[model samples]
Target chain A: MKSLSLKNLAKTYFDAYKGEHVTAIRDVSLEVPAGEFVSIVGPSGCGKSTILNMVAGFIPHSGGEILVGGTPVKGPGPDRGVVFQSFALFPWKTVLDNVGFGPKMRGVPKAERDAIAREYLALAGLSHAADRYPNELSGGMQQRVGVVRALANEPDVLLMDEPFASVDAQTRMTLQDELSRIWEERRPTVVFITHDVPEAVFLANRVVVLSKGKVLAEVEVPISRPRVWDRLVADDEFKDLSNQVLALVRSA
Target chain B: MERTSRISAALIFIAPLAVLVALWAVVVPVFGVRPQIFPSVPAVGRAGLDSILDGSLLRHVAASVSRVAIGTVLAVLVAVPLGILMGVSRGVSAFLTPLMRFFSVLAGIAWIPIATLWFGYGFGAIVFVIFNAVFFVVAYNTLLGVSTIPMTLRHAAASLGAGRQAMLTDVLLPGALPNIVTGIRTGLGFAWRGLIAAEMIATDVGLGYMLFVARDFYQTEVIVLGMIVIGTLWLLIDRLILVPLERATIERWGLVSA
Candidate 1:
């Protein structure tokens, strides 16, 4: 069974102010097998985030369904975790507490949840920041905490909506490498959304190109792991896949 | 270093008041101001010392402080929960907002006549005025606070598997706290003024009563003493308590730099 599946999902809303119907996404279907990394790339208003929100169950699809581990998603649950573009770290909570929040919500015991939070914080290279508040950290560090926070829930699938878009180029590259390393270790089925083409090609097992709220292409990246920035850029296979994804984005 | 900074901060507050006192001491006698209009600084000080020796000053201070403490505490306890309930539902908040605004604006001294009639003279009337003054303003501010929380933060909490109770304790309460504290500060300002006014009309053993009674004999020294007490008390409450609380809440819960 596919780890995460969107079966002909569609989202439509009436713009009450404008007095017209708006279709954000339509007829979108994709299956992400367990432990696979898929990146969805599109233009700014192409509804990439709308589709991701649907999968995370933050919004109900106007038509069709989303399933995680073959169970239909009724609403947001522990089975699917989301890392938002805003980082969304609770400002009042320390880094440790923010990471521990998911398990605490799930009724995990204090000692056990604290230990789990510490473990994930260490994995994200943020154990040193356990006592620090979210605002005290830099943007890149905050996003890493955001990622580990979702990971701490032990979800079957992780949904990311432009998680790296706000950081600088150097920080973005470092975060990509860190994310790739984490994904390799945890192997949770992932669906990442972004407008950065090279970033899509670099991080995803398969790139799902979106244009005007529709899936334009799903190109496979056969560039072998363990993936690193400089080495991956030098490989011909990486260049070809990046070019193909870029061409599809431009043509749309 | 921390101690020096703390001492300097205290000095910063005290320096201006010291200058004001020096100016008053020199100007009052030098200008030959009539004793009936304003007492000399030494005369007011002697009146303060006499009240302290007789113990009426302590009684009046205790009565005023206790009434304020009781009314404000009761108001906060009730207002916060009701505000959260109303704020959680858009329909309820919209329906109640106008009503709350009307009542809050009508709070404090405007309620004095009705409150004195309803509760009668003394502690009941004064406390009632203080309670109404605090409740409506705090509730309105709390409603605004809870409503202002971004929807995305709530969604994130829900997706993380937070139940209704957890959401309230961990998200809603903490998120609204900065506003609640701010509300308390603002409301207390209204309540303090209302307390003095109510005490003048309805009570015989408060700072306000002391000031009012002094008017009968034209005891400028006693009146000046009462005025000094009122001003000093308000400064202590605002600077020592409310300001620090507001600062701490904003530092802890508010978004960075907000």
Candidate 2:
């Protein structure tokens, strides 16, 4: 059964200055099941991020509706945590504060909020740099803080919009391992959006390939946990999945 | 640059001014000008001593500083919240932008003539002029700051469960801080100039009025002294207060990288 439902979602951008209306997404719909890691891979500007943004309540749908766990999304709440492509950590806030931001907004007491932040810090392997600002950290370290910040809230759904796209290849692999560790410990309804084929295949339980604002395919992986990048890179199954995703995206 | 390097660079700025001062000292006697038109530097120094000896210098400085302080604090108090509110609402911002622009252009010196007419040339009038100057600049800067924040950032905050106030404090204010600080600095610049002009016309005892009165007696020493005091005071404000405040906010924001 699906945990989150998307029905005929549509979005448009109205350019008042130029007196033109451009449609960004048109009646795109899909369902994400509970406790499953789903990855959406597509060409850039295929309205992939727009779908996630709609579900996350960042932008209003021009048509149809999106429901999270049977409840129609009106606006973003503390129940859904998001990690962005740019790391989006508050520059003025230290690592600890950024991680703890959700709870802080929810009016969690300082002592409890600090404790929750610390727990997530350890989980994300960023406990040592809790006091550092986002600018002071390396790209990987900044992304680690972003992950911890999302995890600290422990929302029903984890929305990732190209969270690893900016990091180097080596750091990306390490982050993928850490992401697997987090998902294993606490299985949330995860929807990861990316334009990277290998990235989507490497971590997702099911890969949803999109083309022109439509779902081209959803392929499930029977791969096991503690997946090693080296072994996966050499595996026939990984290569087949990667090629399939690559072709799907390339065709799109 | 490193911290020490930045400090040295700041100190290096003083060299040009020192040279300018030396040239002015030498040029005054080169033309053999009368003391009535342009007093010797030492005569201006003597005038400074007389003002200090009578205790009026401290009183005037203290009065002007307090008025500016009070006016600026009040302006910041009111402008920031209104600016934030305007930023939050699309309809409101659209409607208010024209009105705010109208007022911002009319800030400072433009308001002095009318301000004195309303409050009758005293502390109230001067403070009001300063208040309007600071208020409009800050409000406009805040609006610009809040508007310039990438919609992606605000959306990111919302998706992460930031409610109205949290979204404001987290995304809006931090994002707008650099602009707000800049606005304050610029506003204070206009306000300082307005204060001097307003004091000249509206008050009997202020730095501007003192200079104007000294001019009646051909006391070139006092006029030059007043100009020096005005220049030095504004420099101190810009250097010691406004510049640091703006730099700190921009640094924390990372909007403008070092």
Candidate 3:
């Protein structure tokens, strides 16, 4: 695990239809210490996804320094693994192969990568799905594969862009619980982006709220470990923190 | 259960052809049609038997099949990589797309006259025609396949440390495979027709040549037999090879929506 720092990150693009340059992210800077879970939440078009995309190196930042473990990032690399909202688990590959892809890219032998894949699949409770294609699995199951696929790479930092947003509510809660458990176990630095307020608070140690391409505020979650919806749904602290972040997002 | 269903499907498919043959048997003699116009079923059957007994049918079929096989293989080998290269670059695809559209429309028999000029009237000319028939379609389809791949998949691969080589093999190749297969199927369809035409004009030892020679002698029986062989060969190729290939990859992998 390694610390991720964004120094004056900005993104500006020319909108062909609008016939003008529009800034998506303007002067955003933040620091995520090693093994920390930080979520960036915002309303639509607030650049939350843009920030994650930039950090993941899917798009270039207009201006900024993105450093992982104090080394500047030039492009997408194994040091920063990303879990996309689409689940992006290669449809042509079986669940096991999809999870094994990272190790395979790193030159791990077939036997070793398969073993590594099995271990991560076990972590996500996806062992039974190893032989199945992504399309064969449910949306929730596919995202589980996505999560573990990133984790199996053992990257310095994991970037999740609204990973659970597409799944249904019940599945989202279950995924959130599983992600929290996984974070507690592995303690990998994660920067999660989402528009869902409670989901941001539920999964992150700190929630950053953004508005109009700028950071508005940050709320810290002091929730205890092993958090689950059954216990936290009605818990006062969880509700308060969720409401606090929701208010920040709404106000933004 | 699956095997039985497949057998039943085959039987259903054959039923109509069987009925058409039976109608041909009755209609020809009942009308007392001249053999020169349309040979009786028995005459065509005897022609088929004569050609097979003389080993000419096998030789012709082999020549035609081998030419098609070689041409398609060579075309795919070249077209797939070229298509992928075009797919990866917007400028390349944009510039080549219009050319691909024009050439694919003019692919097949249109190339035969020039092919014969270039390669002479023989196997080379026929195969050149077949190659042209297959190449443009496959390349165009491959380009379409690569371009249609979701950006997120590439993002996931790159972030997972996929380098240039790995991205091409692991992501682009497999991701574009379904379309490539589809292209091969469609291109082969065009190539099969082109092969018959090219063989008639440019070759002395193929099914199309057999038909053309029979027409000179007014041997309608041999002509009808050649037509049946051509149609049956295509059916077998499509059903026995292409469909199963599609099922094994595209359908089995759930790449295609229901």
Best by lDDT: 3
Q: Tens digit of lDDT per residue, candidate 2, span A23-57?
A: 77877777778888889988887888988887888
For A1-252, candidate 3 gives per-residue lDDT tens digits of 999999999999999999999999998999999999999999999999998888888889999899999998888999999999999888889999999999999999999999999999999999999999988989999999999999999999999999998999999999999999999999999999998888888889999999999999988898998888888889999989998888888888
Per-residue lDDT of candidate 2, residues B1-258 (tens digit): 699998897779778878877877877898888999788877888999999999878777887777788889899889998898888788988998899889878887788788878888789889998899899889888888899887766776776678778788888998888999998898888888888888888888788888888989999999988898888899999999988997787876566862
lDDT against the true structure, each candidate: 0.89, 0.85, 0.93
For candidate 2, the per-residue lDDT at B221 reads 92
- What RMSD value applies to candidate 3? 0.9
Which has the higher DockQ value, candidate number 2 or candidate number 3?
A: 3
lDDT by residue (B99-202, candidate 3, tens digit) is: 98888888999888888899999999988888898999899899989998999999999999999999999999998899999999999999999999988999
**What would you estimate as the lDDT of candidate 3?**
0.93
- Estimate, for each residue in B227-255, the C-alpha lDDT of model 1 and write its tens digit: 88988898899999998887776776546
Candidate 2 lDDT at A95 equals 90
lDDT of 1 at B61: 88
* Candidate number of the best DockQ: 3
Ranked by lDDT from best down, the candidates are 3, 1, 2
After superposition, which runs of candidate 2 have C-alpha atoms over 4 Å from their true positions? A7-29, A62-64, B1-7
- Predicted candidate 2: interface RMSD? 1.6
Which ten contiguous residues of candidate 3 chain A have the minimum total lDDT?
A: A243-252
> Cα lDDT for residue A53, model 1?
85
Q: What stretches of model 3 exceed 4 Å from their correct place?
A: none
